[model samples]
Target: MAKWGMVIDLDKCTGCTACTTSCGMENNRLPGENWQDVLFYQEGEFPSGTLKWFPRPCMHCENASCVEVCPTRATYKDADGFVLIDWNKCIGCKYCMIACPYGVRFYTDEKAPIQPDVKQVFKGDGQRSWNPPWRAPDSRDDWKHGVGIQPNGVVSKCTFCYHRVSKAPKGTPDLNPANPALREFTPACVVTCAPTARYFGDLSNPNSEVSKMIANQRGVRLRDHTGNKPQVYYLTGGAGGAVPTDRRGKKA
Candidate 1:
């Protein structure tokens, strides 16, 4: 079975925030909520100063503390080794939020954002043209189905766009679609990255490019000492002076 993972090459990342914006738009996340975020860190001094741009998405830990602590089993790891939240099962306890060391999870206190004038047209029999329904407006019935703004009183976070990956076009010989074990690849952020800074593939396949990159680059996972064993890895140092300290430096 393929152990799906991500490799972020710091060398290629410009901290452009395209990935962040794309993730938001694709997921229809709340205006103030972000499934993926970029953090800027400052280091060194005066003349020799340096900046670091750290883009953080869910770490999808092998030993996910968030999953372990969720009283409702709302958060759990998927078969492909990605941590996911079952919004239907989530009870807004925010235990996952507290348990995560990376501060990635979020609780939805109110209904997801609504744009009144926006219209959606469904294709097929009894197809209708109408505005996308809201959870509050629909009495929270919408929360039980499809991707949309999460209902009120639920905890939500990045699922690495599991829905999109599940629907992506199947494989070729090099991509090998016939193998059931080869399925369950692709994530939204990886597909959205403009500079291709984020790479995703089976890390367990030694012949895979991600595996080769891991062998070649000095990759590091955030808070590795905590024993989360995150599937995401970051390649250190690049032309951008070691990462940006702020949005201003990020644009620099």
Candidate 2:
């Protein structure tokens, strides 16, 4: 029942893309498609200008505009309050993409990886053709949940690695059973972060580390004025640093 969330400290982020690569591999995403990305934004005058790197991922907003606009209902809020995509049901209309404030959704123009055809020699089983059973017409239903493939012809985005998090062991009574406490229930990007700038936990629990960090730090959500109520929070600098600004010198 805990509201899962993430906090990223810009101070500790070094712009290394370990997190991005890890997320792609962990989710078996198609090449050039990233579940998370680090973006560089330049601001200020020529003499005093500065470049800042911002890591962007699914905000998992409480009022998710993406979910509201999906005609197929492929995108919906999961029981744990994280926005998820049911790729099988997605029609690839990309309505969700247009509605998303964070630009997290992606559509694949090409087919995902198919099982490679294996060549068999004449001596092997009396000239028998070798092919993975899973790829066989009848076996498709059996291996539906296996890795390295997602349902084709649909939209995709960060699920917070819900499949992996759901499989982690339930540790203690104090923690949510779905995501254990002893083991860090991080999405792939969080685990691969070189600087360990990302932190994930139950934001609903007032005593949780993420909750305390949010309370203690000067955290800000992107485009909060839109009333998206995003769960992701960012800590850009120490208490007195200048507020983050966009390319046009407007507050971000």
RMSD (Å) of each candidate, 1 decimal: 7.5, 7.8
Error of 1 at 69 (Å): 0.3
Tell me the TM-score of model 2: 0.75
lDDT value for model 2: 0.66
Model 2: weakest 10-residue lDDT segment is 120-129
lDDT of 1 by residue, 150-229 (tens): 65567777776666454444321112223354333455567667777887766677876777877888778878878988
Residue 43 Cα positional deviation in candidate 2, in Å, after optimal superposition: 2.0
Tell me which residue pairs clash in candidate 1. Answer: 51-243, 52-243, 52-244, 53-243, 53-244
User: Clash number for model 1?
Assistant: 5
CA lDDT for candidate 1 = 0.66
Question: Please, what's the RMSD in Å of model 2?
Answer: 7.8
- Model 2, 41: alpha-carbon shift in Å? 2.6
Candidate 2 per-residue lDDT, tens place, 130-229, comes to 2233332432221112223344456777777675554444421122223445344457777777777888777787887778888999678888877888
- Winning model by TM-score: 2
